[model samples]
Target: MTSTGNIRPMNDKKYKHSVAVLISDGLGTFEFGIAVEVFGLTRPEFNFPWYKFMVVSTQAKAVNASGGVSIAANYSIEALSVCDTIIIPSWHSYSDKKDALLIQKLREAAERGVRFLSICSGVFLLAQAGLLDGKKATTHWKHLPKFRRAHPQIELDENALYIDQGNVICSAGSAAGIDACLHLVRKDFGSQIANQVARRLVAHPHRDGGQTQFIPNPVAKLERNAISNSIDWALANLSEQITIKEMAMQAHMSDRSFHRRFRDTTGVSPLHWLQQARIAKSKELLETTNYKMEHIAELSGYLTHETFRVAFKKRVGVSPSAYRARFRSD
Candidate 1:
C-alpha cells in the first residue's frame, strides 16, 4: 500500500470498497468535506476494511471550490469505472447542467449497480442522468419547490431527511449526508462497525431517513405562541391518558379554535401531535430500558401495546423492538 498525505490511489483488492466522489468547479466544500471525512480518511488501526477514496474530477483541469479556493482534483472521470460507489456531494445550483459524457458515464455506472449518493442539489445530477426517474428522492428542503417544478415525474418527498431507492440514494443538506453514509456503512458492514464509526465521529449511528426534516418557521411560531405552553404540558404529562380537551383547556381556547390553531401553528392536528409525542416517549424508553411492551405502552400513554406498536410503526418506520435492537447501547 502506497501512502500519500491525504489523497492516494488505493489499488489493493482486499480493501473491498471503491468510492468516487465527484468534483467540479464551485463544489460545496462542507458536503465534499463530509465525503472525505467519512470515506477518505485512513483507519488501519481500527482493523476494519475501509473505503478506497477517489475525488474524480468532472473536468480535466483543477477546480475552484465554493469559496474560490483551488483544489487539486487529480483523478479524472475515468476513475468512476473503478468505483462501486459514486457520490455527488453538492452541485453549485439546480440549474447546473451535466455534459453528455458525464451523463453517459453515470448512466453506465448505474447499470452496473453502483450506488449513487446525492447531497443537496447533487440530486439534480442523478435526476439529469435519469437515475431518479419515477423514484422517491429528496434533497435539501429549501430546494424542494424548485426540484419539484423542475422534475415533477420523480416522487419527491420533502419531509424525508433522505430516501434510499436501493441503487440511487439521495440525502438532504449537510448533516443528513453523514446519516446517509452511516446507513451505507450499516448496510455493507453491520451495526457494530457502523456504531464504531459513529462513535469515532461522535454522531448518531442511525437516524431513520423517514424522520421529518427540521422546518423552523412553524416550530418557531408555535414556540412563541400560547400553544407551546400546552405542548409542554402534554410532554410532561405523557404518562397519563390525555385528549384534545386537555390541550384546548390548557391553551384556554375552545375545542374548535384549538383544533384550528394547533393545526395552523404546528402543521399537524392535535391528535397526530399527541400520537407523535407518545411514540417519541416510547422510543426513548425502548432505547434506554428493558421495559416490556405493556409497561412501555402504559408509560408512554398508550392504552394498549397493540396501539403502541401500530403508532410506533407508522410514525417511526420501525417496530419498537426493532428500533431497540438496532439502537440500544446496552
Candidate 2:
C-alpha cells in the first residue's frame, strides 16, 4: 500500500493514492453513492491527478443494495493490498457474524498501514474485525446503544459527526459520510481543492467533525426559521463581540425562549455555537493567509491574542501557528 501518513503539499503534479470502495450485500446505496461521488468520479478539470478509484467486493461478485439495487464488483478483496485507502460504505445486515476471510484481510491491511474508513453501520465490520478495539469510533446516532453494547472496549463519541483516529475514520450516518470524505480530501490535497470539490458536489465546504449532529426537532417552522436567521446574523458578524442578548433580540424572542429553541434547533448552546463559528473562521484564515497571529485573532472575533490562542487551541487541539503549518494551502 502507498504511504498516506505524510501527505505533501497539493502543488504536486500527481496524486498517486489508490482508493478502493468496498461493497457488499445489503449496502446503503446513498452511502455507497457518497463514496463513489467523492473519490471515484474523475475530475479532469483539476491540474493534479485525482484518486485512482475502483469498486471491490469481498467475493468479487454482484451484490444487492438496499431498495433492490444490484451492483457488480469487478475487483475482489485482494485488490485492497495495493490500494492506499479502503472505504467501507456499509456492511451486510450489521450482523454479529463476521467473515473470517474478510477479517483476516482487514487485519493484514491494518498491519500494512492502509487507511480504513467506515460509513454508518460499516463501523460494525471494523469493530468485529477488531480494528477499533482501543480506538475512538462513532456510527449513526440511532445505533449508538447497540454499538456500545457490542463493542464495550471502543470509546464511542455520541455527538461527533465523524471521528478520525489517524488511519481509521468513522462517520455518523448517511450524509455525514460526505463530510468525512471531504475531510480526507482536504487532508490529502489542500483546503482550496477540497472547497472546489465541495462546490461541485453542492455541499457545505467544511463542517467540523466535532459539530453535533442535528437532533430531530418538532418545533414550528416559524421558530426554526427565527433561530436559523439569528445564526446567519451571528455568522455574518463573527468579527464582533456577539452577546446572547443580541442574538436573542435578532431571533425576536426572550433570552429564555431563545435558549431553548436554539438548543432544540442546533445541538449546541448559542455561546458554544458562536465559539465554534469563530474557531472555524480562524482556521480558514490560517489555511489561506500568512497574517500574524494577532491579526488573525482580531479577525476571528477574539478580544485579545491570548484569548484567541487559548480558545483556538482548546477547540482545535492545536495552536494557530501549528495548524497553519499543517494545513496551509499556500
Candidate 3:
C-alpha cells in the first residue's frame, strides 16, 4: 500500500480516476469541505470522466476535527496508492509532527508524479514530507513567520493566492482554496469547463494566482462624513483631473488635515488611493470595452498614454493590452 506501483494516469481506462483526500485530527473542516465541493460532486452534464473520491485517514480510527467533530474515514493510508490526485485541506496545527507512515505515502506519491495539493496550513504537511524543498509555495499569511522559521529551505510567498509547481500545489489562506481548485479545473480541462464550474459554484470565474491576497478594503465610516462623501465623488468623476486641493476642499478641510486623516483611516495617502481607483477603473474598461490606449488613459484620469502604461505595469505587473487579452470576456 505504501508503494506507488499501482498509480495510473487520470486517463487510464481500467480503473476510474481517483482523488484521495488526506484527513487527520485537528484539520480545518472548511478547507477539507472545498475539496469535496469542487471534486466530489457528480457532473454528468459535462459529459466528462467522473473521479472516484475517497477520504483517507492518516490514523487507523476516526479523526477529530477542530470543533469537536469526528470524521469516520472510509479508507486508510493505503487508499492513496491508486489515486491520481491527493489533496490535503488544512493541517490545523504546525506544532504537531505528522505520522511517518503518512509522510512516506506522500513522498511515494510524489515520486510517481501523482498530483498533490494543500490548502492553507496543509502546506506544513508537504514541507514535512520534503515535497516543497526549493519550490515556491504559499500558506496563510499569518503563519508566514512560523513557516519561514521551520522550513527555511522552502520558498514561501506571503502574498500570492496560490502557487503551482507541476505536481505539487499550495494555496493561500482559507478562501483562496476556491481559486486554487478552479485553477486545477482550468488546468485539467480548459477555461470553458472552469468557467462552467465557477458559474455552478457562483464564484468569480478567474482570479490569477499572481494576484495579491491582501486587497485594501475601504475604511469604515467616520463621524466626519465629508471625507467619505468626497471619496465617493472622486470615484464618480474618475475621468476628470482631480487634485489634493480639490479633494480637501470637497471634505471641507485644509490640505494638512485631510492628508493626515486620510492616512489614518485608509492606511494610504489620498493621492495613492486615487491612483489605485484610477487603475481599477482602467481594468474595468479594459475587460469590458474595446477602448484604445489613449482613450482609456483619458478616461482613467491619466494625462498621457505613456503615463498610464508605466503606472499599470508598475502596479499590475502587465501592460494594458496584455491584461485585456487575458481577462476580456466574450
TM-score to native of every candidate shown: 0.66, 0.88, 0.65
Kindly list the per-residue Cα lDDT of model 2 for residues 167-255, writing each as its tens digit.
99999989999999998998777667888899999998877787787776678999999999999999999989899999999999999
- Ranking, lDDT, top scorer first: 2, 3, 1
**Local distance difference test values of all predictions, in order:** 0.80, 0.86, 0.81
For model 3, give the 10-residue run with minimal summed lDDT.
1-10
In angstroms, the error of model 3 at 39 is: 0.2
Query: Each model's number of backbone clashes?
Result: 0, 0, 0
The reply for model 1, stretches above 4 Å from the true place, is 1-14, 217-330
lDDT of 3: 0.81
Off by over 4 Å in 2: 1-13
lDDT per residue for candidate 3 within 1-330, as digits (tens), equals 222344455677633568888888887888888888888888866664766677888676788887778887777788776788899998854585668888888889898889888899889988999999889999988989989899888887788898888888899988899889887876565456677888988987766575667645554466147778778989999999999889988888899989877766654678878888898789778777888999999999999999999999986767999877876656
Q: How many backbone clashes does candidate 1 have?
A: 0
lDDT of 2: 0.86
